[model samples]
Target: MATKVTEMNEVKSSGIPGLDTLLSGGFSQGRVILVLGEPGTGKTIFISQFLYGGTTQGNENSMFIGMNEPKSRFMIEMSGVGMDFDALERNGKFSYVDATEVRRIPEQAKVGRIHVGGRELGLVNLIDMMQEGMAKVTPKRIAVDSISDLVFRFPTIEERRPVILDIIESLQTTGATCLLTSEVLSTGEERTVQPEEYLAEGVILLRRLPRKGMRSVQVLKMRGQKVDTTPRPYTITDKGIEVYASEEIY
Candidate 1:
């Protein structure tokens, strides 16, 4: 949930204490935020917290469109962190759209738990499905688990670029604050810039700390907000991703 922004810079709380402080409030209202990290850096946990917090605490409607994971597995994983997506859905505050099996499933067919229908499940079809889902739930906060699956579905960069841009553009039109997760190809000091990093209005990067299993989070950029770009230590606690904004990474 977010406060009504009377001014252009007014923000909403990310619901994560240290993260909100690092964001200087929270993410800009209705803007697309890119959460970038390597596989185990808790990007999913971050977005899950955002949506779950909004629906459960802020009285907001939320949706999750997952492209790489099944709804069952996703729910089980989130349950470990104390999020009951099933309950939220039962209460009409949450919705999940699973697109993991789009490539293999035939049109208008049910593959296990996912239902794929109407067209061949390409980029265009996925966007259409998203729009349909939006019309039903009309969420205020939305998350696309990882746009990387859709990004890499095509063979070339020329083809991939427009697909991603189109998806982002479509999300922007929904009037919902959106969080799109993306995987970092390289985890070391040097990393290539991905298109989503520059395209989204805000970017949050997570990195694995060199000291064993810890993690670090940084706000790379936020278009209309004064952001703290400092790298802060964070950890995946039982509740969820917790950031130590004022603490040094050592």
Candidate 2:
């Protein structure tokens, strides 16, 4: 069964090991969080863990909307990381929306609790699909694997900012803790802050350190909570992402 509705100020565990310690508990309940990182920086795995953990441990229904990856590949890859979405779906605690296509989805279409198949989706249709799914299952945790596709459709940041806000607003309407993954587009050493970083209620950045193959996670900002904001070492284990919150990334 899905968890009960929480107050706006309550903390909701992020579902990743050691991550809660950094957030003084977890993300602010029902707020949207931006998970910023480059390709292969474990962004997908991070959100998968959050969703899986919520269903298995927190008794919360979870939804995953994929904008970049196919549902088959995503399920297979996530299986390698020990997230048995198949089982979760069987138990009626998980749902997956295949939104790889950004065309348009029918409003009257039924939303599935296991996997809602869609040929294409637009920004408006995407929000409609999410609302239909939320109305169907009332999931307490929702995640979008990556919003880069949706954001890049706009020519500039100014155009993208309002779109991102609309997405966030749709997510918050259900009082579910939302996590949206965004890609960092910088090729140079220095980083360019994304507009979503300013729009989200929280921002968590994952990056590859100077040392070869070493990864780190940092919480840049989390509204209504005092986050550590430290650059902590992390790893993508067979089970899932693990953050060494007690240790520093030196």
Candidate 3:
């Protein structure tokens, strides 16, 4: 599972063991990645492991922006998987922005909510807040738990696309590889090009098949490199999400 890291300087370990092998060591160091899936597909767990794995490395830092759930819920959820969410924050190695709280208290969101610019924050303010958080942490990685809430808030795909693109583009400037999770419709093969899927440097899709409750991961699109696009079964346990990179999906 080892790759010549010296030759591929832009690749960094994804921290998810099996998935790393599929990514040729890992994803491009500072590109934005989209993790798309429906409910219960492990998108949250996958990204949580990314942050949790990096923050524990001592010198590396990470930030998680919870746009759909409260910050407390995120701490509780990840802690269930043996991740020390609170301790990392307390140690100043991890930062969290509660975008859901910003929705409830728009005015107070900017004072310390970490916006790119402003004393006023609203529902549309998260992209800016995320940028500010990125600057503060200088994180090696960043993850936005799920972008579904932001999609619902925007009212139309026309409005959603540009804003999402802006957020992804903004994160790129911070020099941190980012993972933005999105919800899929579960309609299978035929699908429209979502704004996030179109703009991201890579897209990893998680699906729960109607038969046998099987869950699988697919590397839909990974720009500028070859990747294993085969669907692989994955598991979510107390340890977290793991992809069977070398196994075939039944």
Query: Each candidate's TM vs. the true structure?
Result: 0.88, 0.88, 0.85
For lDDT, the strongest prediction is 2
lDDT of 1 by residue, 142-186 (tens): 998888876765667767677778888999898888999999888
Clashes of each: 1, 1, 2
lDDT tens digits, residue span 133-248, model 3 = 87777788899877766555566778778767777777887777789998986547787667778888899999888778688888988887678899988888888888899998
Model with the higher lDDT, candidate 2 or 3: 2
- What C-alpha lDDT does candidate 1 achieve relative to the native structure? 0.83
List candidate 3 segments past 4 Å from native: 1-9, 102-124
RMSD to true structure for each model, in Å: 5.0, 6.5, 5.0
How displaced is residue 16 in candidate 2, in Å?
A: 0.2
| Backbone clashes in model 2, listed as residue pairs | 103-121
Instruction: Output the lDDT of residue 51, model 1.
Output: 95
**Steric clash pairs (candidate 1):** 1-54
How would you encode candidate 2's per-residue C-alpha lDDT over 4-98 as one tens digit per residue?
65598788788999999999988777999999998999999999999988888999999998877778888899999999998887787888888
Model 2 C-alpha lDDT versus the unseen true structure = 0.84
Ranking by lDDT: 2, 1, 3
